[model samples]
Target chain A: MTERTATIASRVGLHARPAAIFAEAAADLPVEVTIARLGEPAEDALDAASILALMGLGAAQGDVVVLRAEGDGADAALESLVRILETDHDA
Target chain B: MHTYSGVGVTPGRVVGPVRVMPPAIAAPPAGEQREGTTTAEAAAGNLRSAAAVVKEELRGRAAKATGDGKAVLEATALMAADPMLLKSAVKLIDAGASAQRAIWEAGDGVAAMLLDLGGYMAERSHDVLDVRARIVAQLRGVPAPGIPDADAPFILVADDLAPADTATLDPAKVLALVTAGGGPQSHTAIIARNLGLPAVVAAAGVGELADGDEIFVDGGRGVVTTDPGDAEREAASRWAEQVSRLAGFDGVGRLADGHRIPLLANVGGAKDAVAAAAANAEGVGLLRTEFCFLGHDTEPGHDEQVAAYKGVFDAFPGKKVVVRTLDAGADKPLPFLTDATEPNPALGVRGFRTDGTSPGVLARQLAAIADAAGQSRADVWVMAPMIATADEAASFAALCTAAGLQTPGVMVEVPSAALTARHILDHAEFASLGTNDLTQYTMAADRQLGPLAALNDPWQPGVLALVQATVEGSRAQARHTGGPGRAPKPVGVCGESAADPALAVVLAGLGVTTLSMSARAIPAVSAVLRSVTAETAGSLARLAVSAPSAAEARSRVRARLPVLDELGL
Candidate 1:
């Protein structure tokens, strides 16, 4: 598994447009990815491709979350997901 | 014909088939089992197909939508096909629940989770429920619960509209809006005004109207007539003609006899200033400075403040821009300036009172306004809000002078200020009647509360009496300071009341020299004002102020104004 961590940068947090954008990007990637708040248990991780799960995660702006992916292109997928999470969509 | 009355928020008349927004879907019965030997796997399969259909439908609509509407529709579409929701529903189906019950329970579970997250996340729960309803409706082979899909323009009647629902409304498809609940200041009314759609709110019994029912809605009069006669249809047609003929404001406001009444726009920030200028507003009457300090944790620095104010001032190079200093507290509390835990923030340390706690904030803001004024060609006049006594007005005027800004004024929002306008005007250069707050303080009604909407109305005789007193006091002060020949110190109204055409006429008669409102209201007010002379307006004002109640005052003044009918106001 390839893992990466990024802090939310959208002013309104990882919800609405930002969450939708991130979920769509993750779904289009080759590897299956899961996300969890940094301090949350691994078992509490949610499917990163699901907008519902991303919104339900309630990761506000400045919150740090961990992303884990598994497959041939897992490292590249994690890098892309981290980039999406760190960019401010509101701006 | 059954006639219902409500407060008309926007003006126009339309007769159309009604489309009642479907209510929220009912929760499926608990412990319901799949019938007729339908296995859990088959029920799960049905749920998936239903979800797919709902998703496709939303996706199609999303493709056709643009901007914010497109984003909202796309988000909802994603919710319909969310794997988390499908997984939970399949689990429920495995426990012997029907497809409808399974999806409903799963949706609720997800919604509850989102709600638990709080604030912005909590609002998304509504989107989940809306998606769930669509899926459930698909499964049942029924119409989805929301704004009905209609090919022709229709009147939309609802108990009240949620913000999400109102946001996606297509104005081309909706002729008018009628609601059983909500007041003039409700979200429905505001959205309808922005869209230029005629609307009536707080009309009791409108909820009983069925789809396809023909109704005539006179938005200006707030009357909804079911099974209307030929006369109503003719009236609607007349309204349509008048609406088409209503030209843009020609950059001036005058009575029939050529008495000039300067029309201005109440703007929040630089964007609104630009829009107002595009709409040909003579000037900015109330430049609410709260936009700068609202979201900040601390006072914005002098340069940042100057830049923000300059953007607005630059919009109107030679026009008057009355800048109201930071009105922080009550409905608009700032994190750094206001006490969040006040027992009654509205009556607490708000507006001008904030300077007492944070002394330099107002002074800094004034200096910034002065700095911005110096750089721009706009005639910037400053005012402070919620000043009750003459001493408060005197202190505020002194602050403006010390900051090197001239033409300082005080808002006559508190009843005391209006009653003692003479003394207050003695200290200040001018007075602006903030009718919304003036009405609120006079009637002892919270403007935000729907039940008090009647009392909070600016047309209330008690409020009008105070307005007349303010004008009288201003006149008295002008006479004392500069003899009877000097014009009354430019008393203007910067409030929602100024937007109402009939009320605007009455205010003009009451000696208000200027009327400031939303830019969209300028054309209608300018038209209505030109239809009556100053003497006619004075008589109408007398009729309104003499009435015992707000309803009486409104009806009396409207009855005398035949121009309202001609213009379909």
Candidate 2:
């Protein structure tokens, strides 16, 4: 399994349009991607592909969140998603 | 011919075949469909087939949709075919439930979870519900529930229309709208008026009407007739044509005796401002500043505020623009500014009262308005909302002056402000009446409550007395300065009351110097104003004030203005 931490860059946080795009990206990956608050247990985290779960995080801009992925191509998938999380969709 | 009577919110006449929109689906039974249908294999197969069919339909719609609508449709499609959702449904199916019941239970679970999460997730609950309905319909081998495609223009009848449904409707294909539910102030009514479509709301037996039934709707008279005779159709057509011709007369509003009552438009945002300008509104009466602040997590900065205000101000150069400051309360809570919880937001800290806690927001907004005014040649006037005391009025005036904004005024939305209008006007430059809120506050009835709609009527004698008091207050102030009593300091009606032609006449008679309303309503109101002299309008106003109830006041005023009936108002 690979883990990554990134700050939410969207002005409106990980919700609305940005949340939709992020969830779709995770669903397209070959690995199982999960997301949770930084330093929290993975058991309490949610499937990264669930749009409602990602939006429920209430991760505002500049807030830190953790992402985890397992199985083949997990590392590559996590990096790509991290890049998306750090980019401002509003811009 | 069978007939039904309803409140016509927008006036026009049309005849067309009826198109009934299917109401929302009720929750399916939460158990197995039959005694022997408990096989997991059968349930899994059913779930897959149902999801696939719903997904394909959504994808087809997504392909045809464009712009923002495309994204929403595509998202719904993705949600319908979600692998997790399919797995969840299969789990229920394996637990001794039929395929339809399993799918229903799974969808309900997700919808409840989303709603429980609240905030942004809660908003998505509707999407889940809609997708579930589509899948359930597919499993049941029934047509999906929603609006149907129309090959031609038709009169749409529905229980009620959600904003999402209305956004996707093709206005050109809709002749008129009649609903079994909703009120005159409902979203359906507002959208119909904006689109120039005739609409009647709260029509009884509308749900009983069948598809393709020929019907005649006289929106002005709130009358709907089934299979109308030729004479009735011809009369309606003639009346509609006359009203259309009257709309084409875009001259300044005036009575037969040439009493000038500047006709303005109440614009909510920049787009409405453009439409109002196109309608040849002499100026803008109520430029609501709420759009700049609402829907934002944080207060908009000075630059953002400047750009927004400038967009509207630049549209109406050298035209009068009266803007009301931010009016937020429990009804419209902004977490960054207003308190998160309030027992009653309407009576809580809102409008000008917000200045106490969020002083920076008010100061920044005033500064931005001053900047916009400096850049544009429009005659900008600023006002504070919900001001009940002379001290608050004076303080608001001082703030505007400090920001270099002249012509500061107050809105008479509160009953106390209306009662002490002379004292309030003494400090402010002018005043505008917001009859909607004034009626709500005076009647002690929430405008949002449908059953209390009668009490919310502006025609109520009690409400009229408040309006009369405001006008008289302004006059007393004018007389106190030893100035002529005629045309005192520009008291205007910039509310829904000003939109009704008959009510507009009565308001004019009550010493209101200007009238402002939605741009589409300006033409009808202008037509009515041209027929009534100032003296006749005053008499109508007097009669309305003395009437016991709103219904009686309306009849009395209508009797005094017989030409209103002739014009189909």
Candidate 3:
């Protein structure tokens, strides 16, 4: 199992356009991916696509979160997700 | 019988079951969320489903109102293309959040982003009214917005009222309204009160009504009689029948002998323009220019405003369009406005009083009207606001007249001006009562206060007295001012009161030649005209002005005829 923490960088956490973009990215990944928050009690922040879960982690503009993937493309998937978050899509 | 309460919009009585459309819930369809395979994918799937649901719901509403569903589709496309929500949804799973929670949080984030983008769009230039468009899209559910004469009379139950929904509600037939959610500040409350639909809100157990259940509602008392007793049903029946029987009320507003007072619609947008047209308003009395200014940073150039203004102008060909020039300040802020931050924006610079800050704003707004008027020979009237003394009205009117917009007028929202209406109207072409703010100012009560809503009544004798003052002022001006050739331009009620048929009669009685409100309010006003003669309406206005309390005044007016009672007076 490999896990990496990433912060919620997008302004709107995930309800609208951002949800579609990220969903497309993880559409065909060959790994089992899960999400977690630093201080949450393990059950609160598990669903990556669930905007509410990510917000429950209390992640604001700069709060970092953890991402984990286990399977063949785990490393590549993690890197891509991280790259998407870190690099400003427009600004 | 089930019961709930909302503010009474239009006063009318009907016997009918209830139609409670569900609140446009913000969940995605289940299928889209099922698309996710991996744990992260699963999270994305949930988020997609939620988005899909909201999209579908909004799309259905949008499709009903416009061609091609332009606004909803845009919002949906933005949602579908959103990467942030999906990312956060997956991250939520990684973070131990339930898939549902992740989708909600992510959507919130994205909404914030879009709002920011909308703001950015406003700052960039004036093209689309992005924020207003979003609001319009959000409120697009009222297609046909008109309720059919239900096979049986019925009340409407909704979570909240949107402007469109209110626009569609049939005042002629509906009995009353019971809404689950709405505050005093909600447009639903305002429109409900305007329409006089006996309504109640915040009542417990009113939300459980099954479709077609019979109930009796006392809107004035906010009481619901579920499975109404025979007495309640009898009273409701008598009321509905009597009100319906008093139709074909003769003549427009009349004076002592007989003079037709023009009743018009106060329109703010193209939608309102269309609604006003449908309502058969005599003309557009108060054409707020701000609707065109919506969603733009810089003032809309002459051509842009002209196009929108022309749409409204064309809505009622040959009728008068009372265009108020760049009245931005406080409550209705413009992106281009400078130095607008004020603790009490209402009391601060706004309306015609914004001159010292920037006369150019007024100039541009007037210029736009002039440009719009250039296209046709329609009778277009222009006006200004916040005129306390005669000088302000004179200056604003002069500017408009200089630009070729006719019938420059002043809105008597300020108490002092309403009292000295003659002095103000002496300098301008006409006057119109801004009763909502006028009442608020008269009582010094915050009209927006939920608890103090009862005191914000426009019919309060004090407000009526102020209205009387404006009438006296305008009447005196009509006699003394206008000079040899020009007849005193007609004064009217252009606030919330004018759209209300009951209040329309009162205004006509009070001596306002015109009554204007949301285009949707025209029919109700016309109905009031059909219900009573101007002499009776004038008599009612006088009583309304002298009565000690709003309730007392309203009761007296209703007592004049059983028809009023039947209309749920």
Q: Each candidate's lDDT (Cα)?
A: 0.89, 0.83, 0.62
Real contacts recovered, all predictions: 0.73, 0.09, 0.00
Two-way TM-score contest, 1 vs 3, winner? 1
Task: Give, for candidate 3 chain B, the lowest lDDT window spanning 10 residues.
Answer: B124-133
- By summed lDDT, the worst window of 10 consecutive residues in model 2 chain B runs over B30-39
The count of residue-pair clashes in candidate 2 stands at 0
Q: What is each candidate's DockQ, to 2 decimals?
A: 0.58, 0.37, 0.04
Ranking of models by lDDT? 1, 2, 3
| Interface RMSD in angstroms for candidate 2 | 2.7
Query: Which DockQ-derived CAPRI band holds candidate 3?
Result: incorrect
Error of 3 at B197 (Å): 7.0
Docking class of 1: medium
Q: In model 2, what is the error at residue B517, expressed in angstroms?
A: 1.0
lDDT of each residue in B1-569, candidate 1, tens digit only: 99999889899899999999887677778988899699888899999999999999898889988877788789888889898999999998898899999999999999999878754566578789989999988888877887787899999998777656665698999999998877776667767876778899888889899999999999998999999899999999988888866748888999999999999999989999998999899999999998787545457889999999999999999999999999999877676778766899989999999999989999999999999999999999999999999999999999999999989999989999999999999999999999888988898987655566677788999989999999999999989989969988878999888989999999999889999998888999999999999999999999999999999999899898888877888
**What proportion of true contacts does candidate 2 retain?**
0.09
Query: TM-score per candidate, in order?
Result: 0.81, 0.89, 0.67
